[model samples]
Target: MSYKKVSLIVLGSEAALKRALITVIIGGDEAAKSSYLKESEIYENNNYKIIYTPDLNKPSKDIKSVFVYNKDHDRSLLVVKEGFSTGEVWKQIEELHKLTGKSTEEFIVVLPLIHEHTESYPFTCLKISNLFSTISKMAEDRRQKATSTSHADHPDDPMKVAGKPSDSRVNLVLLGMSGSGKSASGNTILGKTIFPSKASSSPVTAECQAEDKEIGSSWVRVIDTPDIFDDDINDFTKKQHVNKCKELSEHGSTVYLLVMHVSRFTDGERNILRKLGEAFGSKVHEQTLILFTRENDLMQGDMTQGAFIHSLTPDLKKIVTKCDNRCVWFENKAPSSGQVERLMHVVHQMLIFRNNSAGSWWRFSR
Candidate 1:
């Protein structure tokens, strides 16, 4: 994972560079056929992919033509043979910049394992043996730079101004079958009727809707989504809803509120958690909180939340356990704000525990 995708420009004999590359790839001194080199100019293994060229003057106009760079690797390398002057190295780098239209900072200058050059240049210099570590360091620097630039560009971001890491913002995503009162729960969380909530035999809120509000001095984004888990829906339409939910929840720590009716658990919801995992990822349960709406019904039945949960069917209890028993009941129609405050308290505690246990909190997989 440390190795980056690199475009190496070797200013030395092709044979010497090829030998070095083979050693780096296979990680041994044992000799092997040069057929791998004859096959293509690109050499790769699990750890790294190297697109190399010896002729600096005829470097590819588009590096992508040589090898398609992936998300993890976008750095370049300049391999200087022994006896090359620092001036010559800079000149070659400039030529490379002219040819590839890449900034000199994107290229890491690599010197021979044993060299006498003590003059420092504008680019980072590393021994050939340490090329992988050098590229990893460069990648880390690039990531840090991008983060800093993002903060600078978005100075008005609520999380930034609140002195919290941007990723610490909480995204409360309401998910369940249709008619599960997800929109009502969303309104309860935001303490306002942001999404349309009504008693309907058919689905309401046909698409994903999101609204943001400050909760406990932290910005919380609440997303009310359509019935993405509906078996009757077409695959394409369901995928569209799922993708939209992911897009809205991309920037923050996403906590899926699996809303359900306290009095009624439908057959479709028997496998709701599994369906969510299938749509998102298996780790989705770790960030999920089971939300049972219509708390008045349970109160009317004179059953405590703990007693009700204890009486849950085997399958339903399994889903609850999957979320580590993080359950909150809401009486959306009630005038009291205690229920909403309690929900926020649970969410805040979950966020704090997750942040403490895991260095980085949950993020949607795009």
Candidate 2:
């Protein structure tokens, strides 16, 4: 999709500036809606609730749901159909832009659908899949911009900065045994090879290293730490590592990615969760997600990742269950954007959950 189309769909209208609904018009066969819904399963699998609506007249206010609609719905968002009048669309989009001056609504998305028969309409159209992909991305950008704007307008008091998060970046601390793919995981999260990763019998990342990247609309900082909880590691060294992790996370909303080899469950792994609580605090599990590397191991066992996880021993199961069953799989040797996108999706969810919790920004494991 062209940047112009994205801008038109998102920032084209004054009414749309404060709009909640990200309206998309899909054009295709009679199965366009079904195809769109089928494609949306990817979003659903990532925990994004997608609401399918044939009628935009009665839209739901479900804040957690991303709405998908078809049909020629009259929405305030700018139109970008072929044969559509560019002058009229711009005029309407500009008018819609005015509605966002002091808008606080955060839940709205309007998507219309035009049959392929209308293909010759002047402005070209994207298929439902591409349309949704483009719109979904634009929506994220809109939210992030809105959030930054909100923060800018209501800056945190200097006195409360110590108690509150002055920065919105999501700090992702990769914690696990050395050679557990912590470095590779960090590289994966950043969608680049910024962190060094190699096969080593000894500890590779002796000290903590951090790198930041802007994913979606938020900044995510990935901190690769040594296996500080390892019994072989000296107490003084472990303590320093623990303090460093805390220092790096002091200013942002933090989520720990507990990296582990998918197939290697050593004795050290059994008590790792408990040790994590000791190093940080009992509530550390609330902000942690288990990230299993070397997914090929599970494949070797003729098992799916979910099945392998469920089939873990009671001790391992306990650790996984403690972190709200939040887990992700990565094949470090090869990295893909889809994998990073999924991981970031989880990170974003963790940040949202933390911010929504009472007083503490994070909720203790129940």
Candidate 3:
């Protein structure tokens, strides 16, 4: 099937969606043959072919492999078994488009059943029954509209409408050695005291905590994690922390803020990135930004942030270089909204660079 003529449906509940797909494809009376092919992960009959998969974010290779067979059938349905936040769902849609070399209309997003009525979704969502006909009609309407209008006048380009950076959300995960002012920097980003911040020889934040605030047209979720890279932390405990961070960051695009004390780049922090790789995946640095707290120390010494970065030791400079020199300093003691805004701008630009580099349609502006 031509991708331009495909229909995308975002609906509620995986089980419900699957049931509906079976009913539509295999007939409600044909219970004897209503079973998914175990090896191929597909359910098909003479009329329709349905491809089933888990969440899109977790398996790029699998998604790509599945799409290799999508073009064989005219009425194919790609059913995603879980749903993400509105921004994340759109991102997945864009990714699906890129992976399949297709348009947004070629995918179907099945949200978790629990969230059917709780939140406002970015795409037009529907309940389970009569999915095929409903999606077919919608796709036909869109196709007719596209044919009648100029390319610029087509109203259903998902990238143009839903993939704007302003319409998306981001998760800022704070990670670094203990006493690196992660909690304080989190408070600065949030523009209030949400995470606990205080001076002590021991760690203040005993666990991962998250909070969010609206900053103009977007929402920024700040996730403050305890020192998972600490040498003394046991493997089991470290795993727990890492898992918590992942769970909290599961809903949106995550930018890890590697918080550090501006004046103190200790021996422990020298290999922090390596340790971070071991905990998270090796691609952690791709989404990492260096956040230096205690900027007042730099101010007192009349040192610019660039000057400070230029003078970093080889070890610290390697960390900065690995993150593409995307670094920002914060004065947590005297927080300001401008600091947070500037940080978010860097984040926006960073995402834009990544998406554009990957040939994505999502765009961002200052």
Q: Comparing candidate 1 with candidate 2, which one achieves the higher lDDT?
A: 1
Residue 273's lDDT in candidate 2: 86
**lDDT tens digits, residues 1-366, model 3?**
222433222122244454444443333233233323222344443233445554444456655665564555343343434335677667766767787686776455533222335576554454322243454445555545655353454244222332334335688999998899999999988888999889999999999998877553346789999999888989999999999999987776789999999899899999999998998889889889899899999999998765787798999989988887777779988886567756775676566456333211111100
Which residue pairs of candidate 1 clash?
none
- How accurate locally is residue 11 in candidate 3, as Cα lDDT from 0 to 100? 22
Residue 68 Cα positional deviation in candidate 1, in Å, after optimal superposition: 67
Models ranked on lDDT: 1, 3, 2
Question: What's the lDDT for residue 298 in model 2?
Answer: 77
Winner by TM-score: 2
lDDT of 3: 0.65
Residue pairs clashing in model 3 are none
**What is the per-residue lDDT of model 2 for residues 1-366, given as tens digits with 9 covering 90 to 100?**
212122221222222211212221221111222223321221121112223322221222321122223122112223233234545643433333343321212212222222123324322333322344455576655444544343433233432321333476678999998878999889878878887788988888878888766666456678989888789878999999999988877777788899988878788888998899999899999899999999877778788765676588998889988887777789877766667765765665565444342211111122
Q: What is the lDDT of residue 327 in candidate 3?
A: 74
lDDT of residue 40 for candidate 3: 32
